[model samples]
Target: MIPKINGLGRSFAGVAAYCLHDAPTPDERSPETSERVAWTDTRNLATIRAERAARLMAATAKAAPDLKRLAGGSRGGRKLAKPVLHYSLSWARDETPDRREMSRAVDGSLEALGLDGHEALVVAHEDTRHPHVHVVANRVDPETGKAATLGNSKLRLSRWAEGYEREQGRIRCEERVKNNERRRAGQELVRTPWERPRHWARVRRERMVPGRARRARGPRDEERVDMEAWRRVEAEAWETVADGRWRSLRHLETRAREEWVELHRRQEEMRQRLDRESRTVLGRLRIWRTERSLRELAGAIRGRQDLVEGWREDLDGYHRDERAELGKAHGERAREIERGWHKFYRSRLVEAERRAWAVRETMKERQETRERERGPSIIIPIPRPRQPRGPERGGGGFER
Candidate 1:
């Protein structure tokens, strides 16, 4: 909430110079700001009386676009010349009324200070960090040249502003204005908190124009809600809220929220990507393991096959050798049997011839008188190997 105060003075140029020079630099203006302004109608007054030159210089600066449309003499603290006497006030962002009630409160301040009428203008300024207004007045009154004193305008303005805050009943017009406009946008986003939508809309409404009719629409019966009366109540309530909730922001919450959202999105994306990579790696590993197992199995089968074939070849060679040995044995056995029979027959015949010779010799020898009686008795036995008795026989073993 910006603090604001009003004043009445005679010189536009003098006041402009004072606000610029005598007052603290715009950098230094604060709730402590105490400066003079004028309220006058140049149309009915002389140049010196209205001080149009000074008023014009002070109101030249424009208000920021984001702020509500400026009413009164200056945007933030500018000086412009019009036919009517203008009321100007210096308002701090920390002390100004909520947008919903600013204009009415400013106007109400004028009346409360007994500075109303007299062909008036109200310039509200916002160019500086702490915005303020300048009220340029004609020394010559619209009714008479009798100069109007500022007459406790500051105290009255402050009191009225304070009262508006404490006397609140319904929501402030500005709050309602802001909440209505913001409600839909926040709802659409879904990311915004539910409570914020209505509050933002209320701020939007407060920024809307306040016309000659005050409220944009009228009652059904054509009776108008007295916005001026409403302003009084709001002013009192403003004093309480202004110092408490509307204090300078500790930090910018909006930026923090955006940063959180972006960070969360990045984290989720990384998690998903990691999960996919893990699955792919796992699948590849499974395939590799399976292939390795199959290759090992195939190698084992090939080794077994080779071993079996080698063993079969060895068995066939062994059987062939055994059959050859058997055949040689049979041939040798048949030869041996035949030779034995021949030898037996030859021996028997020799023995029979010996007997016949001996008989003949005996006849002859008898005549020779036993001359052979001294002949040595000679008998020789033939040497022969024993034959195999059974069907099983041993041949010249290894040679066969």
Candidate 2:
């Protein structure tokens, strides 16, 4: 299970609307695609949003007598900038915990983040291959009106998830376990590039618009590029450079090829390692089986056929589990390779498109510069005879 605590937003309505309706904007509303509300502290989404908004407003109101009830009251009297917590818990693609389990996970996450008993909405979405739920919680406690502390929230969630996974008998994330160990030993936790806040923010800025992180992985229809505009730009650039001379994109092609080759080499190395491990395991298993068979034969000669059968059964089960584990590992590796290739090609395509755009801009600029240097064509104005005075029309007679 992977838990992601998204941005702290300011609007409870906005976050609630997003989770309940699955629509960022009113125009994009699709009730059919909206996930069902699995659990909520309030009666309905609208009511919850309104109640939370009211509570927050009252708590933060300038006219309010008791400023101590406001969020962040102890932190030098600063109001909470963002009080809405948008979080998500997603399971592996093949693992779909039922509604009860999902509810428990959501509850545990909220408690871990110090938002237990806070007004929250849990929506379970089944639109994707993986089972995930979106949690929109108000950080301000309705009763105390104090915003929940967010200190070490990420680490807290990670620890909670580790424990939850252990209880569930599945420890799929070794990195989480290692990080927890490091934390206990007073060592700095190792984080990936995307895990760093600054790097994540930069990537989000480059790849998506502000406040649109949810749709960054897959752009919405309206967020997509206008093909007609792109076509016009391409055509104009091509027309300006119609001399049959084109900028070579061989560098991009070569880089892509080299990367692909490197990927293949890595995959081959992994495959070879897997094969060697498989052979070693099989050899050991075979030797053990031979020894077991010899013992079984001796036992059978001593009229201990039942003991021999039990040993054979145990051997068979052990071999079956081992083979199954190896098969699962091989399949996972294959999937990883496939995903790597997909990402590699997609990134190369993006880079090529960017390069092509730069070339087009350069060509357009050159064409414009050439036109400017040629100077404007002179226009000689030809004088036309006046219409013989407009006396017969509406004029005051012919001009002197």
Candidate 3:
């Protein structure tokens, strides 16, 4: 179960109206889901709304008028008096607790959080996939005439969820995901046989192609075939050429045609090589680099581990020799270097991975463009050669 606490609200009237909204149907007064006012015996929505509104008004009249002013002067905006708190206590669909149990949980949570004295509404909502309750509480205590502070409400809610899970003996969706993450993190980080070490193994071929040309009204921006950059340049070129004022199409067309031909030639060559069971130059280079990087990372990790183990042995010996502080300092230094090296390697790998992704994207776009160029088949019907009416056989007469 997870509790979603939506910080705070200023208007008590708005909070009351939200809580009093008809369940199942907003217009109907049918109370299909259970609802009740906490800290009071009121179960009716209208009565709860009226009672809460009146309590808010009375509290405001008696309480500190400078509360809003003190919490940052009003300035240009409307004075904020966020004394209403909204909370949604949700349970997983699989673990549907009964009305009594739900109420007990809510009561316990509110009391535990020190908001039991505040005026509040607890309405069970059956509309969502998961069973949950909407809590609208007046942060301004009617009896004390002071707003209730929700310090570390998130921490408190997490504690409540854990306790609830223990009591109910059911694991929540969040808990399951957390467990999976922990298990995954603890396991060895080895790539599968089919998985490539470098992220850009998929897109290495396309990034090699040069970008399209545009008319030069001024110095050209260094053209990039990067997806978004290519698109922007394409659009700008189109707009510039389409405008009647600039009448220079020859250079643009010639440059674009040459580039297109080169790109097509490269793609064709790649296809021919694949047919003959040969890898392209770029493909071979990428594979080699991927293998080298993986090997280096593995060696680095192993070396670090071995270094730490050796340091542990030395530390034990030093402690035996009564030079414990010196051993501790050396051990700390070794661990620091290990952490720093790992951090550096992690950053380098991350940068390489991002570049690989860019290459992959470029290749994907090129593949799509190629597919579009190879449009649907054209079927032309050929007229069959006239069979010699070998003598008007139908009429039983020979044709001249």
* Alpha carbon lDDT of each predicted model: 0.41, 0.59, 0.52
* Residue 78 CA displacement from its true place in model 3, Å: 15
lDDT-sorted candidate list, best first: 2, 3, 1
**Residue-wise C-alpha lDDT for candidate 3, range 1-400, written one tens digit per residue:** 8888876766666555555554336576454333532322222223554446535543552354354455543323333367667787888777667788888878877876778876666767665678887776666554444566676676577676767777877656565345444433443223454432222311232121112222222112323224444444445444543342122222333343354445445545644543332124444334335446554344334444453344345444543454334334434543443354335434443444445456657888999999889997689999998765645557545655
Error of 2 at 146 (Å): 1.9
What TM-score number comes out for model 1?
0.24
Task: Kindly list the per-residue Cα lDDT of model 2 for residues 44-161, writing each as its tens digit.
Answer: 2245443364344334332222534453355344677787778899999989699888888988998898877676667777667888888877766664556677867888999999
lDDT of 1 by residue, 1-400 (tens): 2234323443455444444333455576433433333222222223433335445423321212112232222223233223223445444445545443555555565567554543333343444666555444332234332334553444455555555554654223354334434432332222345443233322333221112112222222212333343334334433432332222111213433354455445545644543443345453344335446554344334444453344345545654565455435543543443344335434433433444445555666696676666576668988898876433465533442
Q: What's each prediction's TM-score?
A: 0.24, 0.42, 0.36
Using alpha carbons, what is the TM-score of model 3?
0.36
Poorly placed runs, candidate 3 (over 4 Å):
22-80, 174-400
Ranked by lDDT, the better of candidates 1 and 3 is: 3
Best by TM-score: 2
Clashes of 1: 73
Candidate 2 Cα outliers beyond 4 Å, as residue runs: 23-76, 191-400
Clashing pairs in 3: 203-360
